[model samples]
Target chain A: AQSVAQPEDQVNVAEGNPLTVKCTYSVSGNPYLFWYVQYPNRGLQFLLKYITGDNLVKGSYGFEAEFNKSQTSFHLKKPSALVSDSALYFCAVRDEYGDSSYKLIFGSGTRLLVRP
Target chain B: SAVISQKPSRDICQRGTSLTIQCQVDSQVTMMFWYRQQPGQSLTLIATANQGSEATYESGFVIDKFPISRPNLTFSTLTVSNMSPEDSSIYLCSGTGHYFDNEQFFGPGTRLTVL
Candidate 1:
């Protein structure tokens, strides 16, 4: 079975400061990883995904994630934070084997609070 | 990305009652997924709805408690039967253009509050 872990329950950063939301996963074969953001009372919005290719993947809203195979990590990063960026972020993973199935196993989620 | 809509964006239901959440996509999709997100938690996959076959549920979920229907490629519904306070959560529908890539587009979500 595939699984994801987000060590932080919450992360806080000041506006204009860099921010990182950590994520790690355990899965067999190659792993397909993703990041999503959810605002209060709203559904998840896709941030980015790392299927293959470059370890650095850029995504919407000036967000990016670095996939480190050795660390089994895909940490979301932003050069600078914004108050509007405050929300819950989730990391998800899926095994890319006979499980051609696309079901995603998600992490517990990390709350991001960007103070102004 | 797909344009998805969910009906009855939110509702307060009495315990023991049931509520059916509708999901509609602007374009046809081969597979649709139902997911639940309890307050302050990550999303959990409930089941996968195929156009012509019975929905395949994930572990810890069953068809009896959450019956799913996919009448066609563009529409699906999930009914939360015999509701209880524990069932109160946000239900979301998602779809993907490619099965392998697993890039999902999600609906606005239906919030259920069981009393």
Candidate 2:
């Protein structure tokens, strides 16, 4: 079975400061990880994904994530926080060699609040 | 990246009523998925909408409660039947690009409120 865990329910960051949202996963085989952001009353927007490339992946809105295979973690990071970046963040994982018909498993989600 | 759209951005219905959410993609995709997200919760996969075939539902979900249809590669629908207060959630439709590596794009979503 594949699963994702986001330990923090909320993360607070100051404007112009770096921020990080922690995420870890459990899967049977090699994992495919992704990050998504959601605003109130809106759908989730794709942030970035870790398939099989470099340890760090850059994404939209000046956000990035580092994939650590040994730690089984994919933590979202941003160099400078913006008020507009405040939203809900989700971490998802899928087993690369598991059931071909399976869907992605998502974490409970972490609420990000960027204060000015 | 594929652009996806969903109809009825929001709807309020009484108990025992049903609401159908529509999803349309700008480009044809091999896999169309329906997901449910409760208030302040992460997305939960409801079913995999397979074109020209019956949708494959996830555990704890049933076709009777949430019937799905995939007439083509670019369009699908998910109906929430006999809705209850517990059924109030945001339903999202998602799909992947042609390349396929488990990366998915999502629609804006339809918020359903059952009274």
Candidate 3:
């Protein structure tokens, strides 16, 4: 079974400071990872994905995630945080060898709070 | 990227009633999926709506409780039958492109509150 784990229930950071939201995964075959952000009363917006690429992948809104194969982790990062960047972050994984390859198993979302 | 839209953004319904949520994609997609998110929880896959065949539901979900229909490649519907408080959640629909595209575009979810 393919699964994703987000250890933090909430992450607090100050404006202009760097932030990191942790994510880990367990999959059988090569994993296709994804990051999504959901604002209050809004749908999820795609941030980035790590399909078969360099460990470091850049995404929208000045966000990036490093796919650490050895660690089985894909942590979302930002050089500088903004108050507006505070939102619910979700980490998802898809296993190419799984029974339903197109299905995405999501982690319990982490709420980010950026203080101004 | 594909643009997906869902009808009845938010609805408050009484118990024993059924609600049907419609998902429409701007372009034809190879696969469509339905997901549910309870209050303060992660998203869970409900089923995969096949183009011409019956939907493939996940382990805990069954067709009787949540019937799905996908008559074509660009549109699909999911109906929540015999609604209850436990069924109150945000239902989301997503669509993915051809084989090579692994990214799935999601629709603004439909919020349901069963009384």
Candidate 4:
């Protein structure tokens, strides 16, 4: 069975400082990782994905994630956090093995609070 | 990215009644999925809507309780039958493109409150 884990329940950061949201996965095959952001009462917005190549994948809003194959981690990062960046973040993974359904296994979300 | 939209942004329904939420994608998609997000919880896949066939439900979800319909590639519906307070949650519709284009876009979820 494949699963995703987000260690942090919430992360608070001062505006203009860097921020990181940790994510790890357990999959049998090569993992297709993704990051999504959800605002209050809004749908999830696709931030970025790592399918193949490029361990460091850049996403929307100056956000980037480093995919560590050995460590099985894909952590979301930002150089300078903004108040507008405060939202809920979810890390999801899809198994690229036998199943082609493209069903996503999501992690427990991490709430990001960027204080002004 | 595909633009997905869901009807009835939010609704308050009486217990024992059923609510049918509609999902429409701006363009044709290869796959459409329905998810449930309870208060302060992560999203859970409810079922996968298959065009012209029966929906494939995930564990803990049933056809009678949550019947899905995908008449076409661009439209689908999820009906929550015999609703209860526990069924109160945000139902999200998602769509993904072809094999190479695998980014799954989501609808602005339908918030259901059972009373």
Candidate 5:
């Protein structure tokens, strides 16, 4: 089974400060982890993914995520937080080898609030 | 990247009525997916829509309650039947990318409010 866990329900960060949203996962095989952001009343937008690559992956809006295989964690990061970055973030995982490869298991989601 | 569009961005229906949501993709895809998100909840996969085959629904979801149709490689529809207050949620549709990794691109989603 492939599952993702986002421990924080909400994270607050001051403007221009670095922010991190924690995510962890469990999968039978190699994990294909993804990060998505959903604004108010909007659909989810893909941020970045970690399939097989460097531990640090950069994404849109100057956002990045660190994939630490040792910790089984893929935490989303931002160098400088902005008010416009406030939104709901979701972490998802997909199994590398399985009949249910197309299916994605999502986390509970984390709300990021950037204070001005 | 795939461009996906959904019809009737939002709707309000009575308890006994049914509503059908349409999803159209600009690019051809082998698999399309339908998801649901209730208020303050994460997205849950409702079913997988594949061309020329019956939609495969996830656990706790039935075909009779949420019938799906994949008429072609680029279009699919999900109809919510016998609606109730519990059915009020945002229904989303997505298409898998052509790449082997199968990244997904999503539609804006349809918000249904059952009264």
Candidate 6:
């Protein structure tokens, strides 16, 4: 079964420093990875997605992710964290094998805390 | 990206009562899904709402407990049947573009509190 794993429960960083949220996946075939952000009392918002090309996929709100195939990881990163960027992040994956339905398997999620 | 919205942003209902949450998309879509997000947990797929067809529910979920309806390409509904305190969670509706097969956009979600 295709699944996603986010090792960190929470990540704390300074407002001006860089931030990284780790994500790894296990799938049968080529993986379709995605990153989503959730604000308080809001739905999960699509940030970025990696389907075929381009390992470095940039997303909304100045966020980007690197898809490392060898390591089976798609880590979300930002050059400089902002206090408003603090929110919950979820990594999801779907294998491009037999299933054509858009069903996504999500990770446990990581809470981002950016201190001003 | 398609804009999605859910009715009754938050509601408190009694146990055993059922609540039907409506999902309306600004534009037509080919795929619509319902998800549940428990407190302090990740989102879990509840079912896939197919237009003019029975919903395809994920494992550990059934059609009776969470019946879904997709009247058209831009409208869907998820009814939490025989609600209990365990059903108290945020129910979200999401969909992808008609022809685009990239990312799925989500609605604000309906926060249901069963008392």
Question: Tens digit of lDDT per residue, candidate 2, span B1-115?
Answer: 7889999999999999999999999988888999998878888899999999999998999999999999998999999999999999999999974465567989998988899
The sequence of per-residue lDDT tens digits that candidate 5 reaches over residues B1-115 is 8889999899999999999999999988767999999865799999999788889999999999999999898999999999999999999999884453567888999999999
Clashes of each: 0, 0, 0, 0, 0, 0
Candidates sorted on DockQ, descending: 4, 6, 3, 1, 5, 2
Task: Specify the highest-DockQ model's number.
Answer: 4
Question: What is the TM-score of model 1 when looking only at chain B?
Answer: 0.94
Residue pairs clashing in model 3 are none
iRMS per model, in Å, is 1.2, 1.7, 1.2, 0.8, 1.4, 1.0
Cα-based TM-score, every candidate: 0.96, 0.96, 0.97, 0.98, 0.97, 0.98
lDDT of 5 by residue, A83-109 (tens): 999999999998888675378889999
* Candidate 5 Cα errors over 4 Å, as ranges: none
What DockQ, between 0 and 1, does each candidate earn? Answer: 0.74, 0.68, 0.76, 0.85, 0.72, 0.77
Candidate 3 CAPRI level: medium
Weakest 10 consecutive residues, lDDT, candidate 1 chain B? Answer: B96-105
- Each candidate: RMSD to true structure? 1.3, 1.2, 1.1, 0.9, 1.1, 1.0
**Model 6 C-alpha lDDT per residue in residues A1-116, reported as the tens digit of each score:** 88899999999999999999999999999999999999999999999999989899999999999999999999999999999999999999989894788788999999999999
Estimate, for each residue in B1-115, the C-alpha lDDT of model 3 and write its tens digit: 8999999898999999999999999999999999999866899899999999999999999999999999999999999999999999999999996643788999999999999
Candidate 5 CAPRI classification by DockQ: medium
Q: Which candidate ranks first by TM-score, i.e. highest?
A: 4
Highest lDDT model number: 4
- In order, the Cα lDDT scores of the candidates are 0.92, 0.92, 0.94, 0.95, 0.91, 0.94
> Worst lDDT window (10 residues) for model 3 chain A?
A96-105
In candidate 3, stretches whose alpha carbon ends up further than 4 angstroms from where it belongs are: none
**Residue B11 accuracy (lDDT) in model 6:** 99
Query: What's the C-alpha lDDT at position B47 in model 6?
Result: 95
Candidate 1: lDDT of B21?
98
